[model samples]
Target: MAKSQKLLTLCIAGVALMSTTSGPTTAFANDLPANLDQASKSANQLKWVRYTDPAEGAFSMDIPVGWQIQGGMFRFGYFDVRWMMDARSLDAKTIVRIFDVNVPPYTLPTRYTGRQGQPYSRPQQFQMMVSRYLDGQSYAELYAKHRFSDSCKIMKPRTSDWVPTLPASWKDDPGGRGTQGSVSFDCDTSDGPRVATVFVRTTVYPNGLWFAAPISILSTPDRVTLAHDMVQHMIDTWEKNARWEQYQNEMTKIGLDRIQAGFQQFMQQMQAYHRERSAAMNQQVARFESQQSNQAQQVSRWGETLTGLQDVSDPMTGTQFQVFSGPKANYYVNGNGVKVNSDVSPGAGFHQLTP
Candidate 1:
């Protein structure tokens, strides 16, 4: 890319970062005449404007005018970021957030040895993700408890409906996808009782890590519907900036080359440093090896767990195996090393496995 183009891209990104974090959203949300709290009565009057991330300009979303908006793509560590934002009514009754920062990575402590097995604890981080399955509703309920107050009560609506939106492609992802879940809650806050409905979406990968995000709308019980509509509108209209993505990709490549060069130099220095620490480092390898073997045993199980699979045991041979969990077929095994799923018996000596 030309130097001028690079400079222009940075300038645009700079503008976005300022706008989102500085909360110029309240100023740009100018198209609507009615306030967000009042617009709840007649959603048709609501107007929206594009809110772009100043950090990378990677994404943009249409948000209702007049809402007090802040937050944007935040860096997590080297080469990773959680793109998100928070928007709310001037009255502070309605809020819409894209991602939860406090959620932990899907990886379990058991997956790692030594200090890596511990949960991430900085001096204090109020929110985080967990190893829980995310089919949407269950996660939504969990999210409610964490994002809201602990004592918050989930109210199961009589309708028996819990539909949330998800992409069919999520299932095809290497990390299996989860169905969206929605749940409403009556939460008690310092101000008073408020009703909140949260929707969660997630996808789990083979490494026991999952990408998940939540969309929530909260308000007084009387205003919940309005908040819901506003949140839904944003979800439906959210868009990504392809140009910004290209710029990021270009920058990433440039940065990666620089990092690789620096890393090579660092490694050379580290080799000498490690020789001095080798005597001490050797002692820890044995402990890690023991844990590594245990981790090996759980590899398939953990993969199944993250991918929504399960283990089955064949009574005839007293052998066990893992397969996708579903009611579609019976899993069987013969003298083979493992089992396979079939509609009927594969042959004699092939016993159906018990789930």
Candidate 2:
């Protein structure tokens, strides 16, 4: 349970903290003026442009010139970027996703701190918010290109109503050639002898992974193959990408697990080191305390020795007595130090005189 929790947290944190950007989208027909319905319809034909870049570590097919790509900008880690593109004023669109083989640090620690008056003000805080919303989450987009003499249209049908009419051999492919799932749709109109429509279905994975499946339908059977082939190629590319992504994710999981184990081992080693250091310090302190105690005992013994030296002994009498002197010691009757002369030695006399 603990391991599971840790894994979940790590994955969620990674997704939540990924970087992403948003740009303006081509205005849909609903937002246009009521009086210019025909002009609005024609203008809507230009919905997507060509996107040449790869996404999620996958490459993209060539996009014809005169088209611009738009929508769904995704940034994973520090260098991975992914997005979908719609040709402007046309019913055709391309989706581009990229992932860097090698990535640097996603962001600095200071970026998340929400510091006051800093260059990256609230960066961390913003990242936290985005992560909270997007962690462990996935998303996808349905895109298309429509070439109209004067107009184009993009549609997003609700999930319950979406069912694709696929080609004959769609089921035979290893990828979900005929399989249907919860999908999003895109439709485009082109400028030709008559009206034509191209349909797209997009399936998204919650982990910020997605696949685009397109089914082309035209008024005549002759144009059907071209439409089918175009979408078939896109689907093939998406399938390749999905498989590659799966492989990458598997490898990433294995690598992260190894790293976590290493970190745990390092932590264990550090804890043991700290314990050993603490014990050594305690032993040193004990030794110092013992030395101080011994020194104190020696000082007490020296004080006792000084007290004993203050007592004076009378050699002749073999008695010990306290010695006292007033002002300065005076010479006795002789020059010898402390001489007892015959003149002062009449009888055994003791005097406490100020000499």
- Highest lDDT: give the candidate number: 1
Residue-by-residue lDDT tens digits, candidate 2, 1-355 = 3554343233323311122334423433233332322212222232222332333433243322333323333443222323343423233322222211111112222435334323321221222111111111111221122322233354433332333344342232222122233223333435332223434333223332223333323222233333334334333433224554464455446545665677799999999999999999999999999999999878855765666322345544454544332223331222222433222332334422122
Whole-model Cα lDDT of every candidate shown, in order: 0.58, 0.34
**Model 2 ranges off by over 4 Å:** 1-242, 306-355
Worst ten in a row by lDDT for model 1: 14-23
How does residue 105 of candidate 2 score in lDDT?
Answer: 17
How high is the lDDT of residue 198 in model 1?
75
RMSD of each: 27.6, 15.3
> How many angstroms is residue 286 displaced in model 1 relative to the true structure, after the best TM-score fit?
29
